[model samples]
Target: MNQTYTIKEKTKQIFVLLIPILITQLGMFSMVFFNTIMSGKYNSSDLAGVAIGSSIWSPIFNGISGILLAVSPIAAQRFGEKKSNEVSAVVRHGIYLSVFIALAVIILGFFFLNPILNKMALPARVEKTAFDYLVGLSFGLLPLFIFNVLRSFIYALGKTRVVMVIMLMSLPVNFFLNYAFIFGKFGLPELGGAGAGFATSITYWIIMGMTWFIVKTQDPFSSYPVFANMREFSWEKCKEILQIGVPMGLSTFFETSMFAVVTILLSKYSVTTIAAYQSALNIVSFLYMIPISISTALTVLVGYEVGARHYKDAKQYSWLGVLLAILIATGTGVLVVIFRYQVAGLYSNETAVINLTANFLIFALFFQISDAIQATAQAALRGYKDVNLAFIMTLIAYWLICLPVGYLLAHFAGLGARGYWLGLTIGLLAAGIALSIRLIYIQKRKFTHIQVKEVV
Candidate 1:
């Protein structure tokens, strides 16, 4: 009875944390979704441009966000150990790290902008629109990175609701701004695809400002005094963050870059192909929010348990998270399969685009299971501070195996876009199996250590 009750309590806690994180993620992605839908309605070329711009920018942005995510587990562990003061130092260092990375991305964007586009050899119009979109979007990198730092800090402290509320507020603001700028409303000239970028940049700044205002005024964050050490910079702390974060960032880069590469490859086909791919990808990404949210909460929970030296509890949390993720994926995959056509139709009205997108959704069903398992297991491993192994595995699985297979099947075998997704399915399966095994091995090793200590 006692064990059952404890499990029930833990499950409830996970849900409480997971729900808000899930909503927050959906809110974040909605900005992109709105841009995609609005752009699709505006013009197919613009849609392709948005797709290309998103593929290029998202990986860079997400990679940096992943690096800052190291703050979450680190802060969670410290908080669990009752080392509250240390959390502030972590936040400060995280801010410095965010600034550095944002500047690096901006510099790279400026230098490589045209050369990279020329290499792709995209349709001249698509290429021009994508270039303009990226230029407008680049302005938001600083605020976006800073917002991520604050989000990681707050999420680690288990105050996810605050971030969720802020993200929710940004959704309408983003929509309104996109409508105004994209259509030449409110005395603004129509900028077509570039308008989406401008709206996104402005929305990010608003969200950042609102988030800062809340952190400054909120009672929940008063105890940490996160701003108290703003001027203090510690090399050791920065190094510590990078040690964990670099691998995490690389892991994210490897995965997102694989998709970006696929997008680039598809761009060689036609506007219709790219638009269909974008629509399907959007649906898959929406379903992905569930597992990713659960995984994030698991990271904090597992880290807290590990820091408290409750290895058994930590292991339980990890497995529970994986189980929950798979179950949720199973349900979502079923619904997506059932309503695949309807979902595709939501993104675009073109018959060719809708038909192709619907077909891709079938493959998405199988990969969803693999994706959930790998994501949750990776998060658990991060909680154990076992980060590098996953990164190496992902690099091997996605780059060495998946991308090569995808290219061969798409170009050589004449399977086209479908071939790339097939390759992704196989890669996700490999990653899921490898990461799950790693988590099991780590847990068993820790359990053995506890046994040896007990005997001694």
Candidate 2:
């Protein structure tokens, strides 16, 4: 990157990074999207089961992946520093750390899954389906975590299109597997909602294999020698990753688990309620990828500039990325409002489910606006390595504010799912405003430090 860039130049760079990441994000999310749609079609019970199962696992998956996400910015900064050896070492270590984290999740999962489900007290059929789904899904955790490490490393190197290609390649395979396994096709036994988990696991392994193969044989990555000539684990290097990663992972967990908690709480309502919420959530999550993709790009762009001591360039990327995200979100949010009913109908044919989902999307507008701003700002903060504070703020926002307010409104106020969304909107608004203000303060402090050093 140049020492400085114009608005047009920065926008172009952000777009270049954003588009492929967007496609990859969508492709990855569509796996769950397909699962929800297919499960809903099969039966409301199946849909509710999948919804419950997804609520339990998505947070875990994302929190772990969020830790792995640190590899991107870490690698990006090193790449910006032009330290090839450091970059390669971090990538290899990231792969190792993934296994360690995955193992912990597996062990804890064995001890905790049953207890958590029992606490939720879902209907018998739904509980069984959720349990079976998670158990089947468990088989692919190791490969999934490993793939995420490679993905972060590669994306940090600006090889996003490579990941996009591999994700797209896996989509068809996932679709086929879901079809075959869910319906007992091709001699596979029918597993109903649980099959989606197994299908997704198989897909995870396939994509991981593809990514590993590409990284091993590809042009520049081939030289990284990520897999070959392994070196002894460095405690210091691992600490460096953990120091940056843990807070990030917790922040993600706080945000995602808030929603997961809401899902479990909603289990007390009818199956239609659970299915409708999940359906609407899938759309919300799909649209969220728009901003989150920009956020990921900002991490790479800003981290690169920060690493190169170009604070101004990093600031430029930060503002521009957030601006781009808000613009797109505004447009999409409006469109969702305009077509809420039509969009809701896409998820289910039941009139009650459709009506409730449509209303949820109305509340979703506020949620998306706040979320788009905050998500971008949060990602930019990560680029600046300003994670610890962000984590604390996020916990307060989601747990102390969001869940409490949401629970009261949902149960006490009798607003049902809409009440929870209202609480979420308020929480995201708080987080977005706080984080955006902090980003500006960080930029100013950085420049002030630079000036002070010059005088000294």
Candidate 3:
């Protein structure tokens, strides 16, 4: 009865923790969906431009975000150990490092944007549109980077509500900006697809500014100055941040590169097909965040448990997180199955896009479950300061397995985009199983060691 009740409690706890995050995740998805819709509303070229812009820029942004994410687990572990003051230093250094990295991206993006877009075999109209968007977005990269660093600090402190709040506040701002720019409302120039990028760029700075305000005024334990002190910069701190962040950054590159490469391959099919793929991918990305939120919670929980030397509890919390992820994922899968058509229709009206996306959702349903498991397990591993394995696993899964299989299935087998998704599904399944077993083994070993030490 006690075990059953404990399990029930964990379920309730996870729901409480993750539901808000899911909402926040949806809000984030709204940012993507809204941008896609705005572009699509204008014309196919507009939509294509948005897709191209994302494909080109997302990898760089994702890689930088991954690097900064290293701070969360480290902060969580330190916070768990009751070293609360230590977190301030982590936040300070994280901001400095993220800014430095963002500046690098800015420089590279400015120099490479035109050449790269020009080289792509895109339509002249779409290339011009995409280039404008890319250049506009490049300016906001620093704001996004700084915002993400602050957000990571919030996540480390188990204050996901702040993210949800910021996302909520940003929606109206984003929508208004989209209207003002895309359609030339409020005296803004009608920039079409390029307007979508411009609005996003402007919104990013506002969000960053607002986020900084909230962190400084609202979050009590976070003591970093709104503008970082130049004196706070240190070689050791930057190196430490990079030590934890670089592997994560590389892992993101491996995963995102696989997706981007597949998109490039799929582009050969038809514009309609690529559009359908992006639509489905957008929804899948939102669904995947359910587990991601759980993982965030688990990172804090497990790290706290470990730092406190409560080995058994740490192990239990990891299991709790995994179970929570599966249960929530299964529920989400059912909803996707039931409302697949309706969901697809929300983003687009074309019969082909709706049909293809519905089919993709069928695969996406299964994909989410395994993806959740893998993400949660990986989060547990992060709590243990075991990120190196994630780097190895992602490389093997995405590059060695997923990418190759996707290429073969799409090209040689002539199965098209569905084949590419199937390859991703297989890769996710492998990662799920591998990560789960590894977490269980490592946690058990740690528990046994704790027991022996207690005996001594």
* Every model: Cα RMSD to truth: 3.7, 3.4, 3.8
Among residues 3 or more apart in sequence or in different chains, the pairs in candidate 1 whose N, CA or C atoms overlap within 3 Å are none
Q: Per-residue error at 61 for model 1, in Å?
A: 0.9
For all candidates in order, the CA lDDT equals 0.85, 0.87, 0.79
Candidate 2 off by > 4 Å: 1-4, 37-47, 122-125, 187-190, 264-279, 348-356, 407-417, 447-456
Give the Cα error of residue 228 in candidate 3, in Å: 7.4
**What digit string (tens of lDDT, one per residue) describes model 2 on residues 1-456?**
333458898888788778999999889888988887787777788889998898789888888888988998998898888888888888888888988887888899899999999998799988888888888888889899889889888877876889999999999999999888788899999998899889999999999999999989987788786786576788888888888899999899888888878887888989988988988888898899899999998998888887777777788889988888889999999999999999999989999999989988999988999999999999999998889888888889899888889989998999987789999999998999999988999999764445111332
Tell me, by TM-score, which candidate is best.
2
For model 3, residues 1-456, the per-residue Cα lDDT tens digits are 011125567566556656667777788678777887898898899889987887887777778888888787777667766676566777778888877887888788778888898888899988988888887777777788888877877777667777888889999999999888888888889999889888888889999998888887774543544354547666886777787788778877777888778877787888788888988887888777878889877876677667767677678778889888888889988898799999999979899989988998898888888888888988888878777877798789888888888778877897888888988888988988988888877876655555223432
> In candidate 1, residue 429 scores what lDDT?
81
Q: Which candidate is the best by lDDT?
A: 2
For model 2, what is the error of residue 44's alpha carbon versus the real structure, in angstroms, after optimal superposition? 5.6
For model 1, residues 1-456, the per-residue Cα lDDT tens digits are 011126777788788889999999989888988887787777789889988888778887778888999998888888777787888888888889888888998898889988998998899889988998898888888888889888888888778888999999899999988888788899997988878999999999999899878777786676777778578889999998898888998898889888878887888988998999988887888789999999989998888777766677778889999999999999999999899889999989899999899999998988899889989999999888889888998888899878888888888898998888888888888998999999999998764345112332
lDDT of 3: 0.79
